[model samples]
Target chain A: MSDPAGVIAIGWPQLLLATGFMVVTGGITLALQLGVTKALWLGTLRTYLQLLALGLVLGWVFRLRQPLLVLAIIGVMTAVAAQTVVRRAPDAPRGSYVRAWAAMGLPALVITFAVTGLIVRVEPWYLPRYVIPIAGMVIGNSMNGVALALERTFADMDARENEILALTALGASPWEAARESVRTALRAGMIPSINTLSTVGIVFIPGMMAGQVLAGADPLVAAPYQIVVMLMVATADVLGSTLVVLLTFRRRFTPDGVFLEKGWRPHAR
Target chain B: MDVSGPSGSGKTTLLRTLARLMPGATGSLAVDGQRADTLAPQRWRALVALLPQKPAILPGDLRTNLVLPWRLKVERDVAEPGSEALLSALDEVGLGGLPLDRDATRLSVGQQARVALLRVVLTGPRVLLLDEPDAALDPESSSALAQALVRIAATGTAIVRVRHRESDGLAARRLVLTQGGRLTEAGP
Candidate 1:
C-alpha cells in the first residue's frame, strides 16, 4: 500500500477495506434490528461523497494558490458553520444565527491568520494548504463552542428566570442579572477544548496528528503541530463562547430590564 | 397601602407593574416629581424595589444574600449596611438567630421570605413593593414583619403591600383588586 513517497496510498481497494468496517457496523445494527441501519448507510454514503467532493475542490484550490479563492472557501465554510450552530441550538432566541456567524467567524478567522501568518509563518500568508485546514479546525471547534454556549444560555434563562428577576428587582441591570448564566454557559462551551488540551496525547491521538503520522511524518515532528492545533482550538473556543454569551444574554431581558417569560418570541423584524 | 384580592386576582401583576418589571405594562410612573421613563431602568428599580411572594435565595451565605443588592454596579453609590445593622434588622424581622454565615438556601421558606424582604428594605428604596410578605410566616413572625414595615414606612418610603390576611393595621389605605382587574377602595 506504500506509495513512492513512502506514505500509504489509500486507493479504491484500500477504501473497500475501510468500507468493510462500516459493513460490520451495519450488520450489527441489522442483527439488533436497531432501525438506524438505513440512516447509518445513508450517512456513510453522504460522508464518502462529501469528503470526495471536498478533496477535489481543495485540490483545485491548492493548485491555483489564489488568496481570494482560499478566502472565499473559508467564507463559505463559516456560513455553513453558522447555519449548523443555529440548527444545533434550536431553542436559542431568534436572530441567534447572525450572532453565531459573527462569534464563530471572527475568532476562527483571526486566530487562523495569526497561527499561519505569525506563528507557523507560512511563507505566503494565504497559502491554501495551511490556511484552509487550520481555518477549518478553528471554525469547526468555534461552531461547537458557540452552539453549546447558546443552548446552555437559553436553558439557564428558563431555569433561572426567578433568580434573574430577583436580581433585577434589586436594581441589577440585564448584564448583572445574566452574569451567572453567562459564566456557566461559557464554562460549558470551553470544557471540551480544555479536556482535549489536558488529555490530547495520553488518551488519544487527535485526527490531525494521526493523519500526519500516517503520511510518513515522524511522530516527534508531528507532536508540535498537534500542540499548536489544540491550543488554537482552546483559544477559539473561549473567544467564540465569550462573544456569543455577551451578545445573547441581553436577549433574555426586555429593553426595560424585565426578564422575558419562557417561549417569548422576539418581535418580527 | 395594602392591596387584597382573591387568589386569581392580579395583585402580583400590579406590584410588578409598579416596579416596571412588566414589559407590556404601559402607564406613567413618577417618583418624587421625576418621571420613571426619564430614569434608567436600573435607577428606577433602585428607587422602587419589589419583594416577590416566592423568595429567591441565591447560592451563597446569608450575608451575601442580604448584601446582594449592594454588590450590583447600580448600587455602588449606596452604602451597604454594617453587620450590626444587618443582625439587628434580622432580629427585628424575627430571624435574629440565623447567623450571617449560614447557607441561605438551607433556610426555611418563611425565613427566606424575611431575607428577601430585608434585601429590598436595606436598599432604602423610596417605594417598596411587597407581595404577600408574611404569607409564609407564623403569627408572631407576621407581627414582627408588620412592625418592621411600619417602621420602614415612617422613614417616608411608600409601602405597597399585597395581603390575603386581615390587615395588620399598617396600611394607611387599602385597595382590593376585583375580578375585572380593576382596583377599588376597600371599606375599612
Candidate 2:
C-alpha cells in the first residue's frame, strides 16, 4: 500500500500546516503581551529562509561528488563550527580558536572517514549526500562538547583559584593542578551524548531513524543505522572534547607552570 | 627574614612569584644560582615552596594530604615519608595523636594550618616561603611552629615569613612592605 520508490514529498500547501502552527504560537505570544512575539516571528522567518537556501545548495552539491568540492564544504563547516565554539564559550582561555578548530575538526574528520569508508562504504567516499550529513552531525556535536568543556573548565578554575594555586605551590604541574576541573569539564561535555544514548529509543524516536522509516525503509533496517550513528556521535564527542580540554588547559598556563592571571582572555587579533 | 605589609600590598604575590607560580611577574628569579625559569617548573617549585594563607586540603584523608607532594614525579628526590616520619612531623608541629585517616577537609583552620606546614616540612625544600603561616595558631601552636621553623632553618634552609604582628624572634631581618610597594626596614 506504501510507495517504495522514495519518501513522501512535501509541497507548499502541506507546508502550510507547519506555518500555521508557527503563526498560532506567535499569535499567542502577542496576545499574552510577551516580548518574545517578535523573536518568534523573526526566528521562524530566519529558519525558513536558511533551510530553503540550504535545500537549494544541497541539491546542487548532491549532484557534484567531486572530492575537492566536498573537502571545501567540510573546511567551511569546520571553520564555522570552531567560531561557534569560541563564541559560546566566553570563559574559554585566550587563543582558543585554533585549539577549538583542531578539537572539532580532527575527530570529526577521522570519524567521518571511518563511518563513510569503513562502515557505510558510500561510493566515491566524497558523495555529498552521505558525507555532508554525516560530517555535519560529527562536527556539530563535537562543537557543542568543546564549548561545554571550555566554559565549565574555566568557570571551575575561577571558583577554585586558591585550590589551584595551592597545587601549583606544591610542585603540581598545570595539568595536575587543573585535573579536577578537567575531569569535570570532560564529564560536562559528554553529558549530552550520554543523555542521548540513554533516551534514544524509549523516550523518543531519533530524527534519522524516523526519517529513514518515513522514506519507506524497513524499521529494522533503519534502527541499526541509528544505533551505529549514535555510537559514532558519542565517540566523536568524547574524543574531541577530551583533546580540546587537554590542549586548552595547557594554553591556560605559562611554560613555567603558572596559571595565567589574566585568565585566558581572547587576544585582540 | 620577615615580609610585613598592609592588607592590599603584594606580599602574597611576591612570595608566589618567588615560588615561580605567577607568570606575569617581571624580574629575574634564581633558585640556588640557577635561573628559576630555566629549571623545570615542577623541579623549581619543589626546591622553593610556598605555604599560602589558606592552604587547600585536598579531598582525602590527612595522610594523603601530607604525602601528595611525594606522589608527584617532581618530588622523586625525596623518598616517600613513612608513617613514623609523618607522625613525627605532625608531633613536631603540635598535631600529634590525630588519626592519619581522618578526613582532612573537616579540620579546623588552626589544625589545617599545622597540617599544611607539616606537608611543606616533609618535602624538605631548600627555601620555604610562608604567608601568614601562623595566623590561625594558638600560642602553643605558634610556639610549636616557631620551634619547627628553627629546626628547618638549622638544616641551612632559608625561610621567608610574612606576618602582621611584631617579629616573633624568628626572623633574622625584618622588612616592612609599605603601601607604596617599597620594602623599608621596620626600625627607623
Candidate 3:
C-alpha cells in the first residue's frame, strides 16, 4: 500500500514517456506536410510554453485555497477563452461569444459541480488536483465543441437560406429549416469526442486515468474519476453546443422570422 | 410590356438591383408599397425575380432543383394557405411532360434555362424580369419561350424582358439604357 496523502513529483522521464505517443505522431504528421510542419513546430512550442506558464500561475493561485477565488478565476479564464473562440470564427453573429458562454457555462458548471461534488469525496473540492484540473480540462473541451458546433451550424444556415425560405413558404417554421443544420453540425462536432470516448480504455488510457495510476493511486479510484470525466464531457458537449445553437438561431432570423444572410457568413476571418 | 429599348440600357441593372444580388446599390426599394429590405428575397424574390442571362443551376437531382425555391418561408409558410399547390404548378409552365425528376445541373444549357424559367413560374411571383432570356435558346425553344412569356403576361403579370433583338407583335414600352447607367426612350 502507498501513502495516498503524498504529492507526486512527476519527473521529466515519466513526462517524456507519457507524452511520447502524442509528440511522435504530431511530428510525423508535420514532417509529411511541408508548410504544416512549421505551423506544427510553432504551435507545439507555444502550447508547451503556455502550459508551463499556466501551471506556475495555477500553482501559486491554488496555494490560497479559497473556493470563491478559484471560482472567479475559472470564470475569467472561460470568458476570455470563449471570446477568443468566437472572434476567431468568421461570420459569427454579433453577441455570439456572450450568448454561447452564457449557454455553455450553465450546464458545464451544474453537471461538473454536481458529479464531482457528490461522487468524488475530495476533502477540499477546490484543490488544484481534484477540481481545478478537471474543471479546466472539461470546460476547455466544452468551449471548443460549442464553438465548432455554432460555427458550422451558422454557416449552414446562411448557405441554405434559400432552401430554408422555400420550406418557410411551404408553411414550415424556422426551427424546421434549422433542424437539419443543427443536427448535422452538432453530430459532426461530436465525432472526435465520441471516438475518444469509445476508445478510452482499449485504444489508449486517457491522460487523467494514466496520470492518476502512474502517481501510484489505486486503479479503482482512478477508474471512477475517468468515468466521471467522460460523462461530464458528454453532458457538456450535448448541453453546451445545443444551447448555443438554439440561442444563435433565435438571433439567426429576422423580427418576422426571415433567416438572415449574415447568419451564414463563412468564418473566413 | 416586356422589352428593353437598346444596348447599354440599365435594364439588367434595374432587374438585378431589385433582386439585390447587385453590387454598389444604395437607396430605398419599395415592393407592393413596402420596404425592400424587409422582404425575404429568397422567398418572395421570385415574385419579382430577374432570371440572369446565364442562369445558375445548382448541382443536384432534377427534383431537388425544382422544389428548392418552395422551401422558403416568405413564399410558402407565412401565407394564408394554398402554398402547397406550388409543386403541381410546374406543369403550368412549358415543362409539362418532362420528367419531374431530371438532374438540373447536368441539363444542357438550353434545357437549364427552361428549367430555371419553370422554377420562376412555380413560385407564382407577381412579376418576371428576364435578362437576355432567349440568348441560349434554339429557334423552337425561343418561339416556345416567347409564347410562354405572352401567356404569363396574359395573366396580367408584369413582365420586364430584356433582349438584343426587339420583340415583335407584343404590347411593349421601350426604354433604352445609354452609357453611364442612363435610362432613355427610343429617340423622341
What would the TM-scores of all predictions be?
Answer: 0.95, 0.94, 0.70
Which of the predicted structures, 1 or 2, would earn the higher TM-score when compared with the native? Answer: 1
Candidates' RMSD to native: 1.9, 2.1, 5.9
DockQ measured for candidate 3: 0.12
Docking class of 1: medium
TM-score of chain A of each: 0.95, 0.94, 0.79
Give the TM-score comparing model 1 with the true structure, all chains together. Answer: 0.95
What's model 3's lDDT at B33?
Answer: 79
Model 2, A3-86: lDDT tens digits are 556778888888888799998898899899999998898898999899999999989999876888888888889889889988
lDDT of 1 by residue, A89-122 (tens): 7667777778878888888889999999988999
- Candidate whose TM-score is highest: 1
lDDT by residue for model 3 (A1-269), tens: 33556546767787678667667867788777645656766776787799899888788877878888778776876787678668655666777888777876777677757766787766677665566776776777777777788888877777776555534433345686678788877886677677778989998998888988888779898998898898888778778788878887756665434466652433433
lDDT by residue (tens digit), candidate 1, B94-166 = 8987889999999988888889999999989999999888889988878888888888989899999999998
lDDT: which candidate is best?
Answer: 1
| Candidate 2 residue spans exceeding 4 A from truth | A1-6, A262-269, B35-38, B75-77, B186-188
Question: What lDDT does candidate 2 reach at residue A32?
Answer: 94
Identify the candidate with maximal DockQ.
1
